[model samples]
Target: MDDAIRKAEILIEALGYIHAFRHRQVVIKLGGSAMEEPAALRSTLQSILFLAAVGLRPVLVHGGGKPIDRAMTAANLPTKKVLGRRYTDEATLAIVAKVLREDINDSIVRQMRELGGRAVSLHTGSTQALFGERLKLKGPDGELVDLGNVGEVNKIDGDLISSFTDAGLIPVLPCLAYDAHGNWLNVNADTAAAAVAGFLKAAKLILLTDTPGILRDRQDPKTLISSLNEAESRKLIAEGIIDSGMIPKVEACFDCLRSGVEQTHVIDGRLRYSLLLEIFTKSGIGTEIRL
Candidate 1:
């Protein structure tokens, strides 16, 4: 069939990309609208399997923040978010850690295995006391308060990630971490992914977010800027063009680029094979930020 031939061609192209990037480490932050949509979730799982089958080294760091919020609400716990990071108090942190480490993490491992990919899920505290700083935020009502357990990633162990990757197991890292004194802290998944990418000197940091990429004009889809550097991103932030949920995403991209990650990409994971399109095609589906 002609369709079969077309499919074969596509697969061959994908194989070429894999052969080219073989043994190169790629850290993927799989989250945002992609995780929220049923179709997107299936596509991402399949994409990972395809990448592994083709011999492209892939490491995944996923976000379950939205799921945790739903669980908290279902459990009748008071939930609050500061600067987009969940405020996990002593009580909430227990619930969060349980959901993140036990529920979401296990599900990812199970799904990846079902797809024939060797996936190993892990929590930050499993290896060591990776640290973060608690952030203060203004409440929804504009009240300034310190949100406990909601922190920004300050440190991570690259050795653990490398060991897992070197053994041919894809590391599916959860965003839950522990303080130096053994307190549980919740880190933003984007920041956590970028940290891991930096530590490993990964060749690529691919963020599977909702938006197609960074658009110069938020209202204009065609205004998507293909690439940016640290200084350019900071200037955009200073100009107030970059704010809201984009701040952390931009920060993560900048961090990865500064730390020698070859290229950082923010793509709309809603597409079935956006990762492949970005990797193999000339025109990609999202933004590519570099140093």
Candidate 2:
């Protein structure tokens, strides 16, 4: 295809998405191995800016567990991983807050500024206590453990996030949250994103993952499931077909849908312009979980 024709096609498609999503809120859960890659990082930023420029409100909830692990190792602190979930101890919790909230959140804001979007950081602890719950995930020593100070989000201050959206500013969120007593807690980024989306009554929730989408066969990338309703998703989970790293994400998607989010998408973050393709193209590149 000629360059000008391709550009025109992309422009038209982007305009279509903008028209369809204007005045709608979208919560994006950014994670997986893709974010670590420079190209993927650039793509994600570009996509966010594009969405914002087109009048779609986007709230970015980011994960920094891998960087936290690396920082912990460098600091000679012990790290734990069980069932693909990180077990956060007191030390780990401190590190997580620093990395996710300060470092990662600030970096995203800086990039957004460069992308011509006004962005700011939102920390759960600083704003208000939006999550509370204790869950245990196994540790590196292969023993049953308590993930101290960890949290599962049960609430979100929609007004606070919405205020930013109303101001034409994108809210960049960290996975860390706090309890009613102001106790800091670590939360799964995907879970955090879903809770926020539900609270804000967002029109869409987009989860960027390493996989292409939800696969009928985990071993086969081409066996992607294009769409699924909430009940059918639960059936798949009951059958134990959704396992491993995909489990939490899939569950989060379902949770968001049940909580009244219009649409939830799980897409491959590795592909450049994957976000645009999924949102603006006729043939999307990921699984779309809808209510």
Candidate 3:
């Protein structure tokens, strides 16, 4: 009876958030070690289900980094990573599309269905083409280097996403997009999510990652910063506290905030119910980025 009462109380506590975000759109970027571990993946997906069931329209942008690596290994292709971003060549791009669409995206949709939720995959080709542009990476000398087949979200298909959400369906977006010339391009999932959130003018952009949010010291859990703004984030980057791969993720959140997204959150997806804890409770679990 005590446990039942506690559960009821928790639901009541979540009532306010559920009502506040009702009918609003939220973009979720899900991946990393969170997808690799079965238990973490299940818990996180269930949280997403909960969000949808409660009336907030949720969209998912997912990554397949590990799966792409495995595909590259099978193809006997050399994997080159620069600044936490993959140097995607022609061969590697092919595998990225295959793994992202066929393996990771399809599997996630299947899993979402299994959990009693309706999910749809936004295929990477022209019919969907979540983003329509190519990406330019930085060179060793700080020059803009063009990484072949990599994209950085120039535009998004807002209507397509809205069309699905309007029908009470969750849209599972692939990180890959189309270039100006009608070619497929690989995009980082974080960048993809930020762009989507900005286009949707979403209420929030939630990133489900492996870490315990952003820490003042990467090595120390006790150094976690629960909230941050764009200026503070820039200062951290200038100080090298936020560099390499983390730079892009942080920049993406900042960009989202600047583009009118209300808030962006980076949370530890490994902890069960972390999504609910961050949204429904007074104190969120991760570092929330705002203006």
For candidate 2, write residues 1-291 as lDDT tens digits. 599999998788777777889978988888866578878988898988888877889989999877988889988998876456677778888888898877788888898798777988887545552666776655578676666777788777788888888888889888877777777888888898999998888889999998889887888998999888767778878787767777788888878888899889999998898888888887789999875
Better candidate by lDDT, 1 or 2: 2
* Alpha-carbon local distance difference test for all models: 0.80, 0.83, 0.88
Q: List where candidate 3 sits over 4 angstroms from the true fold.
A: 124-129, 140-142
Taking all chains together, each candidate's TM-score versus the true structure is: 0.87, 0.90, 0.95
lDDT of 3 by residue, 1-291 (tens): 999999999889999999999999999998888888999999988999899999999999999998889889999998987656788888999899999999999999999999999999998554474756666767789998767778788888898899888888999988988777777788999989999999999999999887899888989989999988888988998998877767878989988988999989999999998988999998889999877
Estimate candidate 3's alpha-carbon lDDT, on a 0 to 1 scale. 0.88
State each candidate's clash count.
0, 0, 0
Kindly report which residue pairs in candidate 2 clash with one another. Answer: none
For candidate 1, the TM-score is: 0.87
Candidate 2, residue 230: Cα displacement in angstroms equals 3.4
Output the lDDT of residue 19, model 3.
93
* Candidates in descending TM-score order: 3, 2, 1
What does the lDDT read for residue 277 in candidate 1? 87
What lDDT score goes with residue 32 in model 3?
88
